[model samples]
Target: MSRLVQRITASIRFTPACVFPLLIGGSAIAVFLAVFLLPVYAKNNSLDRAIQDRREALERQELFAPIHARLTMQLREASSLVVGDRQDIQDTPKSPEEAVYKLSLLAEQAHRLGLLGVTPHPDSLSTQDNLAAELRLAGPFPQLRDLLITLLAQPWLHRLERLEISGGADVEEFRVGVSVRMDEGS
Candidate 1:
C-alpha cells in the first residue's frame, strides 16, 4: 500500500505547466455554460410555462361555450319580443273602464280566431295606474300565434305581463296577462 501511494503521487505532479492549463480550461468551460446553455434553458422553461397557461385558458373557454351560446339565443328572442320606447299608440284608453272595454274587444278577437276556453279576468288597478287582465285559452299553436300578433298590433299601449303555456303535445293551454296603462284623467 505504501509503494502504491508513492507511485501514484509521483506520477501525478502539481507542476505549474499542467495546473495552469487545467484551471484555464475548466474556467472557459464554465463561462461557455453560463453564457450559452443557461440562457437557452431559462428561455425554454418560460416558453413551456406560457404554453401551459394558454392551454388552460382555452380549456376554460371551451367549458363555457355552450352556456354563452344559449344566453345569446335567449337574448335575441327577448329582443324580438320587446316593444320599442319611441313607438306611440294612437288610441290609448283614458280610464280603467275603457281598458276593460278594450280587453273585451281582445277577447272577442281571440274567439273569432278560434281560440278555445277563452276566459278573461280583469284585475283591479295597481298603484302605477295600470289595469291588468288575464286571458286563459286553449288552442292550436297557429291560432295562439295569431292572437299574440294581433295583441301586439292593437292601437293601445299595453304590455304582455305574464305568459304561461302548458299542456300536451297536440294542444296547448295559455294563461296570458296584459297590463294597460290608463291616462291620469280617470
Candidate 2:
C-alpha cells in the first residue's frame, strides 16, 4: 500500500480528456440551466405573489360584505319609498291640519302594527308645495316591518331618509326620518 501510494503520487501527468469535459461541458450545462430555469423560477414566484394578493382582496371583501349588503338594502328602501299607493286623494295638502289628519291615519295604522306609542314631531311640519310631517316610532322589527308595509300602502309621497333600529333579539327601537306628501304627483 505504501509503495502504491508513492507510485500514484509520483505519476502526476495531467490528462485533458476528463478535465476538459468537466470544465467545458459542466459550465455549458450550468449556463443553459441559468438561462432557461431562472426566468421560470422568477415567473412562478410572481404568480405566487399575485395569488396571495388576490386571496387578501377576497378576504377584505368578505369582511365588508355584510355592511355593503345593509347599505344597499337601505338605499333600495329609500328608492322604493318614493312610490305612492293607489289612493285617489287630492294632488296636495293645502293646510297643516290636512297633513296631520293624513299622518293620524298613519298613526292608526301603526297602532294596529303592535306599537303602543306613536309621536309626531309637530316642529317637523314644513310647508313646500304640500305639508310634510315627521313621525318618530319605537318598536320591534316585526312592528317596524308592519309599519313600513302600511306606510307603503298609504297613497302618500314619502322620502324615507333615515331608519335606524338597534337592540338584541327580543326588543328593538326605531329611529326613522320620513317626509310625507299628499300624493306622488305633488
Deviation in angstroms for 64 in model 1? 20
Model 1, poorest ten-residue lDDT window?
81-90
The number of clashing residue pairs in model 1 is 0
What C-alpha lDDT values do all the predictions have?
0.68, 0.61
Please give the lDDT score at residue 72 for candidate 1: 50
Question: How well does candidate 2 score on lDDT at residue 3?
Answer: 98
Clashing pairs in 1: none
- Candidate 1 has a TM-score of 0.42
TM-scores for candidates 1 onward, in order: 0.42, 0.39
Q: lDDT at 149 for candidate 1?
A: 58
Instruction: Tell me the lDDT of model 2 at 70.
Output: 90
Query: Which portions of model 1 miss their true places by more than 4 Å?
Result: 1-90, 111-128
Residue by residue across 23-87, what tens digits does model 2's lDDT show?
99899999999999999999999999999999999999999999977975665566355434434
**Residue pairs whose backbone atoms clash in candidate 2:** none
Q: Evaluated with lDDT, which candidate comes out highest?
A: 1
